[model samples]
Target: MKKTILAAMMFLLVIVPALSEETITVKGSDTMVILAQRWAEKYMQAHKDVVIQVTGGGSGTGISALINGTTDICNASRPMKPSERDKLKARYGSRGVEIKAAMDGLSVYVNESSPVTELSLQQLKGIYTGKITNWSEVGGPNARIILYGRENNSGTYVYFKDNVLEGEDYVSSMQSLPGTAAVVNAVARDKNGIGYGGAAYGKGIRELKMKKDAASPAYPPTLENIRSGDYPVSRFLYLYVRNRPTGTLKEYIDWVLGDDGQKVVTEVGYFPIR
Candidate 1:
């Protein structure tokens, strides 16, 4: 009987520690996925007792998860919409907390071999809105211009539509990919292809210098340019929670907004909030 009790006690000791371990769920923003993953990895390394699960289904999806109590953190490339906040307030009686975790310059990408190197915001609007269909229209080869972009559910897509296109619709022919990496990959392979995404995923492709208008000097999405507001399409990357976080959740958020977390942001090719 004593041997049986000793074995049960040993089992409880192991199981209790496992149960005591804390888990954090982070979801949203395909544009922020790599950054979020890097943050999770570094945080987890220091906090062996905490587990962070990160996923990306776009910012809208992540916000929905937060509303439904499915995620502890939602990484958003754009601000939460008014309707979303209303829903959260209705469901949780809290207006959700927003944290500006990093900054990004929304980058326009093209094939490496393309001749076009810069575009005015107006020109970008025309090209994406189906008003300009050929590369020749933008000083490139005579080939047809192929557009690649993210799906409607993406915060990137929403931001581009509102700010770049000025609420105009994307051309029906635009290929809607799942994530920013996919958009970058699509542009890299097609010589006449063009796409937009976070600056971090600009590998193997040419990122165009952006002008606010034809008269403005074009600027690349460099850290200095973005920080100085010279980059035309710079935006904040956010982390949203359903409430004012406390306990382990708050600790993780505090760390993310700290110097070490901002260092990770720069290392991952984004500008720090600070």
Candidate 2:
């Protein structure tokens, strides 16, 4: 009888821990993937019973996952479109909840070898619209310009199109890469290439200082500039949920908006919303 009791005790010990553990799945926004992973790593370290899984496909992909009930949290580099919110309202009877988690500057990346340093919004529009195909047009060398950009499914892609391109179509010759990292890699390898992505991934590349127009002073995507609204392309990063969080989910979300989570944001190379 003592042996039987010991066996039962052992089984209970194993089963209890398994039952106590909780999992949260985070999906979307390649731009925010590194930041999300860091948040998860730190949060899980402090809370031993919680597990977090993070993945990045793109913000659009993440929102779709949220609508389909596949992800617990959706990270987005841009605000959700009205259509997406409408769909969520129709399906779940909730407009969903949006939490601004961090800030980022949409940086334009160029090869380190490139001589060009700054671009006005007009010049950028011309370059992306295929009207300015030569580097010399933008104060660079007399060579053909190569453009790299994110795929249509990415939130960054939509944001860029709406803001930078003014709703115009991207030039057909531009190469659409899968993620910001890939765009950065492509520009790093090609001396004449230029791409745009989140500022966090600007390592080993030159980020162009941006001017709102010819009359305005150019501003680099520094923390001060982004936070102060001096940077022309600064935007907020977001976390979205299908409904008002409850229980463990509420606690986790609250924790994420607190100081510790914002600290993780700054450490991961993005500006904290707080």
Candidate 3:
């Protein structure tokens, strides 16, 4: 009888732990926060024991946290930079694993009330750099462009600067918001405001048309354009994890990659990589 009881207790011990897993800490790009939150919510449904703490401090903040071992995942809308890779390698013995979770066709949005409808990449560059302040300079009414942007630490900001702005500087007049949602709100109300963010945030806001040059008219960003690489500012959203993820970490990562979890990605405004 004692042997039987001992065996049953052992089985229960194993099952209890499998049933209740602790929370996984994930932090990173504001652009991916909405989708990540959705994943976290759904992930918790089957995994009543699993909790995911999702936070946005921008990609840089998330990377920093990852290096410090404070987070299990670093979410990003852009690929890891060399310096950041080096830092992760130094701390974790190798650069953390990069998992491309979804795709985003970024949009430059403005107040719907604004007359401006299109802007070539060059015109956008000029506008953001303070070289061309008036909307009329880019096919709109005579009004100063109120530039809204994600802070320098944001992956969206870095991606935009590297691609569309061609490494140009943001104008001093630009207001740095905390996240993409904030940028959307700012542009939705401010007629003179123009901001760039992930396409997921494009719903209530009007997307600015983008052109490569005078030869191509500005086109609205779309999923097809992003997947085909025609959307100039499209980017991949990723999750960076420590090398050889162990324990629940591995399972959580696997869950996110699975079809059920990835479905949430599309629903939340991102193109699932799967």
Candidate 4:
């Protein structure tokens, strides 16, 4: 009986370690959810033993998950806040790690039928803040300008608010949607509607060319324009890890930053970090 028990224990020990290779969990940023999932799928094809899971709530949710130790990685479209960094130091004894994975122009979307082909930054701010409530105010048909935006938890929302709104509040009438894709869908069907999100999400909707001011030339959110810093709203997309990544996590991140991973970024309609 003792010999049999020892043999069973030995077998269990050997099998458990082999089966327990960590499954990486990536969470956060609805904007980056599609991109992250694509990367995970392609990476998993090459690495049979590894498992990866991706989820999107928002950048804030992902950062919270990182602080609480619930996710292996957090994808964000914006930089971490100072308060968030402090929380990471308190919980993980580190300031957390940020990896820039891609670039985004943070494009503004308008319905294809809208006559307004371009807007200055101040005009965008005025439109979003309710100061310019009519499409006619910006060279469009005389109609109420319906606004669509992301939820407050979204990094895109914060970035837009900080940079475009200039710290002013969004008009109370603006409808806050759950994701960038949702914003695009809403704008695509509404002639007077306008929205803003990652450039990758502007498929059915038309991307509005933006100028620094009335005197400057309006530029589309093309890769060339973004790379040249002509697109004023361009920002980096990021991946966050609790500490210096190690083991399979490190390997996966390395793969993501490599040539093939960046190719996926371009295929997904976002600019690769390279």
Which predicted model would earn the best lDDT? 1
What is candidate 1's lDDT per residue for 176-195, written digit by digit as tens?
A: 99999999999989999999
- Model 4 lDDT on a 0 to 1 scale: 0.94
- Show model 3 residue runs off by greater than 4 Å: 1-19
The sequence of per-residue lDDT tens digits that candidate 2 reaches over residues 178-231 is: 989999999999999999999889999999999999999999999999988888
Clashing pairs in model 1, backbone N/Cα/C closer than 3 A = none
lDDT of 4 by residue, 180-232 (tens): 99999999999989999998798988999999998999999889999999988
Candidate 3 TM-score, C-alpha based: 0.90
Say which candidate scores most in TM-score: 2
Q: Who is ahead in TM-score, 1 or 3?
A: 1
TM-score for all models, in order of appearance: 0.96, 0.96, 0.90, 0.93
User: Where is model 4 more than 4 Å wrong at Cα?
Assistant: 1-20
For candidate 3, the 10 contiguous residues with the lowest summed lDDT are 217-226
Query: Could you give me the TM-score of model 4 versus the true structure?
Result: 0.93
Q: Higher TM-score: candidate 2 or 3?
A: 2
Which residue pairs overlap in candidate 2's backbone?
Answer: none
- Against the reference, the lDDT scores of all candidates come to 0.95, 0.93, 0.86, 0.94
Clashing pairs in 3: none
